[model samples]
Target chain A: MTTTSTKGQRLPQTSKRSAKAAASDKRPDEDASAGARRRQIMQEAARLFGTRGFEATTIRDIAAATGILGGSIYYHFASKEDIFVAVHGAGMEKITQAVLAAIEGVEDPWDRLEAAAVAHCNDLLGSSEVPVIVSPYYSESLKGLRETLVAQRDRYETVVADLVEALDLPPDVDRSLFRLNFLGALNWMPTWYRPSARLSPADIGRQLVQGLRPR
Target chain B: MTTTSTKGQRLPQTSKRSAKAAASDKRPDEDASAGARRRQIMQEAARLFGTRGFEATTIRDIAAATGILGGSIYYHFASKEDIFVAVHGAGMEKITQAVLAAIEGVEDPWDRLEAAAVAHCNDLLGSSEVPVIVSPYYSESLKGLRETLVAQRDRYETVVADLVEALDLPPDVDRSLFRLNFLGALNWMPTWYRPSARLSPADIGRQLVQGLRPR
Candidate 1:
């Protein structure tokens, strides 16, 4: 009888230990799922914000789009501004990374600059499904988020400026004008570019780079 | 006594005629003042809309900026939207006219295109006093205004497209891509352009057009 009682206690202890282990193993999965949910909310929010303006969109709108209750959003993000900051920050980081990576192996400054322009254009117009949120539009409504986004943009521009300066062009070439024109062309694509338009984003980028090259 | 009575009636008639002459003489001055006032209001409104956004700026804000009572704005313009539409419409017309005029005398398609680009860049970036109000950032909010503005833009692009199609380039050269890249480079200038920056808008336009020309 004593041996059986001891066996039963050990079985419960083993079962509890296994249960705890299982719960611990599920944590990363939960975290990943939670992160995905947050991302999903941000995506929906960006579309709405981009179309309807940020101040006009409510957390409930995002919640409804995600098919979650309004209160549930708070579990993932502290506020709407928090989600905006994350979306824009992630977008800038992704674009900067793509641009930086595109020019990594190129030796010629012009080639590097061209690669960076193409990569940035592709990321902005091609891969990223989100709308390009202009910082000035949201500055009043989301001040903190705007500041952070602007800083990120400045850093990205610095990278381009550095590349422009490094290029071995003719003595008469105006480096500042080159950088402005190059960036200006890329920034304007989002305004008039239609995905159904004849020129693909890559094609446009290539043509633009050709235009940017030394005469 | 009969002559005195006749003179009294004649005197009243003479005074009435004088009053009519005075009013007629003041008409051109009144028209000039009204025109000046309209321009002033539009200028103040553009400044406010550019800095604080269209929706956030109330009629009262415009009135305060112009040193007039809020209700006085209604006397000149029907509503805030009316003012915005007018300002945007006028700005677009001016820019379109400037560009079209620049391309008129130039015979070469490439030269015409370059002239148009230079004119647009100079108008947008050179004249610090002139503001580019029809940015895509505010396009969504101004739907009716945008439709008309876009139609005008389509006409402008059609002109450019026709020129591009007529260009004597190799078969492999994508004319549509070339135009897109050229306009994209020009239109995107305002986003990153700083007045205090080293390069003038015309200088940038020249480089862009030079880079775009076929080798």
Candidate 2:
């Protein structure tokens, strides 16, 4: 498990398709500014998706929020779905990095899980933009996009799964369900978490792990 | 706590406005079939909302699904949002009823909570239509409807809260977060749960509770 742990590791891996697309089909003028503009579009689109949901949000809305003309957005991404994929990918990267950094020096398995949880909670509940879009409710209409989002999400999930596998639990415990329930608790926080709440994200994360820790 | 238990007690309370409108504004001819037609609209709309999301789904889709003309849907609902409210209200009533019945005569607080969780899991993950719509990802655009949905959701939440309050846990436990985490785990199931999974809904519910039960 320690060998597999993502601690102190800089994971530069993006999804293969996106990498290939960037290499082959992207415009020749791609530069630092173009990269920044793409990020800007994703950030603005993430905000809208968080507020209005994927379907209700439009390319026009993203362009307007980013202060670019709607047609200009097509220059960066093929469609709204493409923008969503980018935002989702960015969000997954953000949280995955957060979790990896938090668990870097933690040796104990349960403690590592707790650290990851704290980092996850902070990233998810601390901000209103990227993480929210990362876990948007997957309605059937988004079926075509769901596979891509879930695959991206699974990269982060594998880190958590490895941590759960390292825990010293009773043989009867189902580790898969354990990991799912642990994540469900953390991910579900945004629905009820308030910034003013006395429990900071770290506190919430610790409490969650404490509740589930084997006696 | 049992005194406040909703067990065996029928909760007929719907939101005030809906009840009032159902009485005053509804036509006198709202006979058995009219009531059935209204339910049909809600069921179809719930399915669409589950598959297509609230923003993407339209009255036309609901009408088409219900085998009624789009304009005639106005007779059953004033707007798509109205249909959403109806479906959500109906879903709340459904899970509430399932939970209330489940905890009935279960005396131990933990056992009662487990019972409620089992019932909740069954209802939420068992079917595709109602419970799915009940917890739609609330975006900023849905701010006007959030209060109503949250209020309706709270009626069921109170039951869980009361159950949590009855638990004999460490003094340090934040019961509010405890309840939130517990409900979050259960509610998040629909995102990843598959009917083919080896764990039955009952098994999943029991497992969730067992994981949290204090040693």
Candidate 3:
């Protein structure tokens, strides 16, 4: 009964408890291996799901890609949607952590905002799965799973909202849309972004954040 | 003909001309009817294709949506992909015209930029198909279509680049990336934008453009 209800948890609180339950059900060594197996399946599944349409990628494809048996894949994930949610939740967690860590100890509101953008830009540029898995969360195929996916995504919003609040933008400025404009430009990076592009993510992030200052 | 050729053209150029040719080979009214039918099918197909997955949308489904006989759809569109290209191309042309009209005769670069953003935002908010059809241009199902889709998309980039070039940013500003940040933020509106978001699209667009000013 010590477990907290996670209906509103933005982070993956359930994963830890689920792991603990599995640990108690199995030997410690088996528990470690199962966790690793689940992770491996997710990475491969994300690749296939990202490259191949999610509907097109069958359970056997995910299993074969990760070198696991199809029947055993079910032991880790109940269904394909469950795997997608896990992969998506994990990706959101990764970037959120990166952004939060980057702004750590930054005292200036503007500087903190810039730092958060830079961290986010780098993560989007560096991670293959970050954009691929996250972009499809809005698609029709994920209509049933949107609530769960959106909650994970909203966790990142709290960080940006805090940054915007600290900016103390003028009342005339619509702060919510300001935050959205800042984020939209950042997320749109995956569309035209190429490694050959001359500007580093930090430089771009700074330019975007600079737009929020009083004209 | 001095007219530049569109690389990877998916639909017949000058549907009237093609229809006329078909008419000469068939009957007199065929030319006008062919052109009108082509437009009608593309409009309804776009509606369905925008809401439904492109691959998942069958020719029969398109015919049913448009109230055209199943076999006649082939007369207007050689294949499903051809219809897709036509709808996508038409959508791009519509928005391009809107933005161009907005920026026309505006001497001040900043004024031009804001006007352009406002027009774009209004169009995206007002049009149902703008976000839906344009998004699929980036999907894996369109791998064979990427060259054509990207070329059409790049046509819009020239407009943004010209605006950015007029701004005459400091030598330190990465103009290409600066352009991307502006466009990305603007393009991202479709993801989170809602009628109740408390800010009009024009208001948000103006705010985004104002970010271009130096601190």
Candidate 4:
């Protein structure tokens, strides 16, 4: 059987749509000003895309939301698809890094898994837009987005699988199935999780890990 | 805090789009036959809607898939939204009944809850199309779908909550969070589930309950 790997293991191929947009664009200088402007656009774009959907939110809408003229958006990004790719790519990169860092140096594999779960949940809950943008709806509209997201998602699951494999659990325990169930639980939080809800994301994460940990 | 109620607790006021479609018709006998035909259309519509999308699938597409003329679909259902409402409404009703039935004879709360989860997962797995239709995408599209689904969903959760409450676990266990984590694990199975996967749905269901049972 093929081993199920982690999110970091699988990097998605560049979408033709995104690739076309990238090829059409001229890169800005690596100066601080250019970097700041790009960051601003990505932040605003993520919010709008999460709320209104990738297809419904236009270049003009992103520009208007960011206090930049429609043409100005093109100076930083080639197209709306390009912006979407950037937002998703950057979000995954940050989340993967945080998760990897959070679990570092933890001795117990299961404890490291729990820490990763908490860190990932905190990251999702902390950012209002990431969950929405990463939701299946927006992912469906953008060609190649699902593959990219699923690949990154698989990387995260791999982290859990690796931890499970490292554990001295019962020989009968199917680590792959355990990882699938655990990840499924973690990923569905964004659907019902409201910031206004009584439970903090960290608390929820803790409970989840506690509930799923092998006896 | 307001209780997040069951999925089918309250249906929203029909949209003007659906209301107009309902109002424009006049034949009395057509109403009875229309209801039957509407059911037929919805059955077929759900399959198509589940595969594609409610918006992406046209009346003609549904008709073609159902082996009926495009105009014939109009004779039964009012519009696309009407078909959507019927498909979602009817599917939830069936699932609710199935789940309730599964738990009825079992006196043990934990067993009942396990049965309910198994029933739900099996129902979704058995009706390949219904799972997709009842997924987050379709839930997000309709104004009342999520509320309706959650209302029905709460009924299932209530069973689990009652079971969790009766358990001999420590007092510090949060029943609500327990239910949330349990339901989260079960409900999100469709996102990654492949029927051809090594574990059968029933196997996965039992393993999930085993992993999640309070220690």
Using DockQ, give the best candidate's number.
2
Task: Please provide, for model 1 over B21-115, each residue's C-alpha lDDT reduced to its tens digit, 9 standing for 90 to 100.
Answer: 43455576754555566667788898777656676677788888888766666556666787786676667667777888888878997787778
Q: What is the lDDT ranking, best to worst? A: 2, 3, 1, 4
Q: Which TM-score values does chain B get in all models?
A: 0.76, 0.83, 0.78, 0.70
* Candidate 3 deviant stretches above 4 angstroms: A1-26, A128-132, A211-215, B1-33, B47-52, B69-71, B128-132
Q: Comparing only chain A of model 1 with the true chain A, what is the TM-score?
A: 0.79
After TM-score superposition, the amount by which residue B146's alpha carbon in candidate 4 deviates from its true location, in angstroms, is: 6.1
Residue range with the least summed lDDT across 10 consecutive positions in model 4 chain B: B11-20
**Candidate 4 error regions (>4 Å):** A1-31, A52-60, A69-81, A128-133, A136-146, B1-33, B43-85, B128-152
i-RMSD values for every candidate model: 3.4, 1.8, 3.1, 3.6
* Model 2 global lDDT (CA atoms, 0 to 1): 0.78
lDDT of 4 by residue, B1-215 (tens): 32222334333332222322544567646544545555566777887665555655677778877777676665555567777766666666666777788878788766777777788788777654433254443333465555665675566556567767875555666777777667667777776778888777777777777666655
Could you tell me the TM-score of candidate 3? 0.82
The candidates' DockQ values read 0.24, 0.45, 0.38, 0.31
> Which candidate number maximizes TM-score?
2
Superior candidate under DockQ, 2 versus 3: 2
Model 1: per-residue Cα lDDT over A99-175, one tens digit each: 88998889988778778878877877785655456534454567656567688678777888899889777677777
lDDT of 3 by residue, B1-215 (tens): 12222333434444324333656655558566776677778877876665555655677878887787676776566677877777777677777888899999999988999999998888877654433255522556778988887777778889889888998577766778788878877777877888887778888788777656544
What is candidate 4's local distance difference test score? 0.65
* Candidate 1 global TM-score: 0.72
